[model samples]
Target: MAYENVEVIKRLFQRLFRDEFPNLAPAERQAFEAQLEGRIEGLLRGAAGDGKPTDFAGIIGLGPEGVQPFEDINYPRIKPDFDDSVIPTQLHAVAELYYIWQHEQMKIFQVIDVLRRLFQLGQLRIQRGPGARGLYILEKWKPLRYSRRDRMIAYRRAFNYGTTPAPAGAVVNNNFHFQLVAFMSAFAQYFRDLMISEVIKGGVALSERPFGSAATIQRLGLDLRYALDRASYGNILALTTETGQYLREILELLDTPDIKRSFDANTKWDVVEQVSQRHLGGQAELSQRAKMAESGRRALEYIAANDFSTTLDISVFHAEGKALAQHAEAWIAAYRMTAEGRRFPGVERQLRWALGVGERTARQRLTA
Candidate 1:
């Protein structure tokens, strides 16, 4: 599957570049293909391990020795109730979402905290230029130092779909995957913060003093701009293209007649609810899943509408942020009830502290 994924990526790049440079000379095209293959090979070699499955326990900081292979950790098996030809594919998609949610819960919060601190320290300024409402201008920008091991863990979590290990080098050398994830994290924060600002202000404010005096919008703008500048146009196009495809696949699975019948679901959203409760966590609720599903669909439509343009649509951003924030908040509550959260109580406490929420308020929010 790892090799298949690499091949898929190669095909995507080939199609993208071919369309863009349809008039390339035969010799030039040959050289381009050769260089692309070499670059892909180099990425594979740069990762730390040979192409072997990673240890499950070790990757998540459980222990030195791996108790199980990463590939062994999978979504719950659907019972053999009906035609299940697409079950494996559906489960794979859900597992990817699970992986992303697990990491995003931690990483996205870290980004928010960083921006919150910068705001408190007066390091972020509100943008007052024309057409910059509810936006900020970062006073200074610094790349967050994410360790190689951490990056490898994230890579494996997202890409280790088959028995084979994912490439470690794929996360190294500021590769496209790394940049894509970074942009996503930043974007999530931007939207999440925008939601918070809107909630605090109760609507769009006429004043330019700063919406809720938050630094998220500003930092998000800078971070996105920085990511765009660093990444190639091809990389951006590929990212959007792949993301849209995955979203469509997931949505299709949710709406598939066979899947709905297998789960005895009444509506497409019911499938989401069932999957979330069974595989995501015990606390996964119907309402939360609904929000996530709706926002996901909206996101897919937004990507389709934008067509790979890096343009900011504030209204769309705010709407997405609002829905995603609600989902994240619910997810956090659910995660706290999980075994992992029980083992690491400080995680929530640290987040609460960073967000300047008192214990009472945190408890109230969780219970609410």
Candidate 2:
């Protein structure tokens, strides 16, 4: 009863689609299922070339080969004195915090503010404004999309936890990192849903208003539209995980005496400014992180003062959290399997690409 068994995989897929996309029409659901089935078949064929039996295990490279050394694999070069640099030594932790704020575009606070505005006004307007198609719409609250490569780059910058070359002072802490990712991914889903609900509740009826049709503007283009429509179901898990880990790292780094002593600060905000100036560049006054921190404080206060029990379903949040954790566990297992020699021709490439590694000039090898 391996997790990747075809039947198990099919069942999970079915449940995920049904649970996440309850609004889809029956025909549309079936069409999407058919497309998924086609992908599964293609994957199976790729894993089992030469007419071999294509069980899930075999596809993941767990046939008789078992685990073998990747002796031929080349590892990325490490700079001998990379960690000795002053900037990396004192500023790595704060840099991580800055990265999280900038990379995520302050999504948590943005979502909270949107919800706050919607509930306070009893209704929020989302009509398309002047732009190519339209801009500053409610749908912009969805998570920003990043390729696997981009995600991996972020990982390297923050925690230096993969095959890619990390910043000079990149450090790794596997258990902490994984936990952080898991928590963040779950919260991302939670906040995303809240934002979506508020937007729909406030904007759905506005379609009948004088300029209501403008609310349907495809300003973000089709890809973003599709992502928003689906509530970013495909990649929300990954995004949250990335955000969570960075946040945890930032906190942990800041707690260290070395980092604390480096800054002559009366408060944590001063520490933030010092690090931002030295490592991240830009003045703290005009920095995006500064704006996010200020707004985020206000949003939190609003949430604390308001009652949102009707909109915030703890049960649903728990269920989504469990799903995200399970998804992350399975993907991590698959990554390990692929790294440990259960690889097919393109399997390794695809996995590495998705994880944002193995893109360097020399073929990068995975290490445990």
Which is the leading candidate under lDDT?
1
TM-score of each model, in listed order:
0.28, 0.23
Candidate 2 Cα errors over 4 Å, as ranges: 1-214, 217-225, 228-236, 255-261, 279-287, 290-368
Which run of 10 residues does model 1 get worst, by summed lDDT?
A: 130-139
Candidate 2 whole-model C-alpha lDDT, 0 to 1: 0.37
lDDT of 1: 0.40
TM-score of 1: 0.28
What is the per-residue lDDT of model 1 for residues 131-244, given as tens digits with 9 covering 90 to 100? 122112221332223433443343343333223344444421133222222223434555555556668888664122333212333333333233323222222233334433
Q: Candidate 2 on 106-225: residue-level lDDT in tens?
A: 233332233334434644332232210111222354233454456555444443445665445434322223322232333333344444655977842221222211111111112111
Itemize residue pairs with steric clashes in candidate 2.
Answer: 61-342, 185-240
Q: How high is the CA lDDT of each candidate model?
A: 0.40, 0.37
Which pairs, if any, clash in model 1? 47-168, 47-169, 136-218
Which whole-number lDDT from 0 to 100 does residue 142 have in model 1?
A: 24
